[model samples]
Target: MMITKEQRSLYRSEGYMILPGVIPPAMLAMLREECSYYLGYYDCIMDSRGVQTENISHRGKRYFINNRYRLSSRLWQFIFSDLMAEVARATVGDEAWLMHEQWVVKGAEQGMKFAWHQDSGYVKWYNPTTQHKPYVTCWCTLDEVSEENGTVYLLPHSRGGTKSEIITHIKEDGTNDLIGYTGSDPGDPVVVPAGSIVAFDSFVFHRSGPNLTGNMRRIYLPQYSEKPLTRPDGKPWAMATPFLKDGKNIYNHAEDSAENWGPFPEDKNVVV
Candidate 1:
């Protein structure tokens, strides 16, 4: 669906917008089922959904699988869909490339939040070719979510005007990664139904709480942007992969640009 004027305004002003039910049930179902491989393959315990526990394997999170869209066909279907391209067009204005993706499952536990931070700080290595600045992220809920279920809290229009600096290593920094920026506003917890989308500007400050509810909170994140002028020193997405380039699904057509680079090593659980 095309973006409305209100949606654009909200994104520009609030640094985020929740688009309800933008993903159809069929697509959501497929994406959810694909998660089983993660739950089953990892040393996960059995639950109502057939997967129970998970220890932090990668991505600096206690429970998350990173970059599945780089290889998974099913995941790619959701990312490269016409619907995704449409959203990218509206969000980034015509020439957007989906440079990254990840699946996060916040289990019921203490201090399980994704933490509050800006994506632009993480992309400080990226040299943007456009004037739009930092990239954008589309977070799709795979399960019914609530503040009690660890949904992210977003500070409205929080791109700039803050006293914060990017921390280099989140894991090594102890709880410093969770520290708030000077003059930063406390965020509102975002509650969206399953299959809903929460898209945010790159510089928006957002974080979630620990899961108090006895359920797994699942979210699939897709990051959209133009090709990076330069890749991060060691992080991936330093170059363009073009999941959606120029508001089109380039993944389904000819070879996508990778700037002759291959998959980099997994990022140590140093989250943004």
Candidate 2:
């Protein structure tokens, strides 16, 4: 199994766990290639729009590219692989849905910092009435991360808040980031090698610092809900592509589309 029993216990108590260098070499290589392609793709799209900043993305500084899994030839391999399935069954549940996936990149020397907030804060902000259990954020790292290069810092349930509750968040003016916790806690910095996956609960308060090094810091994050998360109006909050049912992968690549997975949410502001 990818996750150990001790790690599972820690996740249950602390709301997060780190798997050190567990991703296979081949899979890691492919993810790096895909991330490079998507970074350029994001740049092209931003260039076409004639803007340096689009929502949370700054042209040469930082990016939060969300939900373009179908466009890649190999992303699905990692997203739906045995490694992810084990993670899903361990954290989310036996049944899981692909809630969101993104390439969060920090440009060399100028990557901006992300605010401290829970993943569920975005859900509560957009769809206030939708009640769902805490999901899992599999933060798959493509590069060795440190505090100097924008590594994520997680506030445990004990310090930040309860994992079962979603705290209200305020939208920051300039970066469009949602701030949930404004405490003095420095948070636990995650320093790990490439191919490590830091699995955290949706309600965990997490943030990252700016990249100071001359090399880019890249992270491919795939978030999974125990079940499909829907808005109060009955529309899906994000992609609900089936991944695990009864502890097994049920994703059919050929049949995957908007029609089958349900239409993606219309409001771009809801993209977190």
Candidate with maximal lDDT: 2
Inter-residue clash pairs, candidate 2: none
Candidate 2 lDDT, 134-160, residue by residue in tens: 999999999999999999999999898
Looking at candidate 2, what is the lDDT of residue 120? 87
lDDT of 1 by residue, 1-272 (tens): 77789988887666677888889999999988877667554443334335343333322234556654544557767887888787777677677766667777766555266666666654542323213365778889898888887888877654444223333213224343433344456578788899988888776777777778767787887777765424434334433556554555667433532333366434322232
Highest TM-score scorer:
2
Candidate 2 structure, TM-score to reference: 0.95
Total backbone collisions for each predicted model? 4, 0
What overall lDDT, based on C-alpha atoms, would model 2 receive against the true structure?
0.87
Candidate 2 Cα outliers beyond 4 Å, as residue runs: 257-272
lDDT value, candidate 1, whole model = 0.63
What's model 2's lDDT at 200? 93
In candidate 1, where is summed lDDT lowest over 10 consecutive residues?
163-172
Report lDDT per candidate: 0.63, 0.87
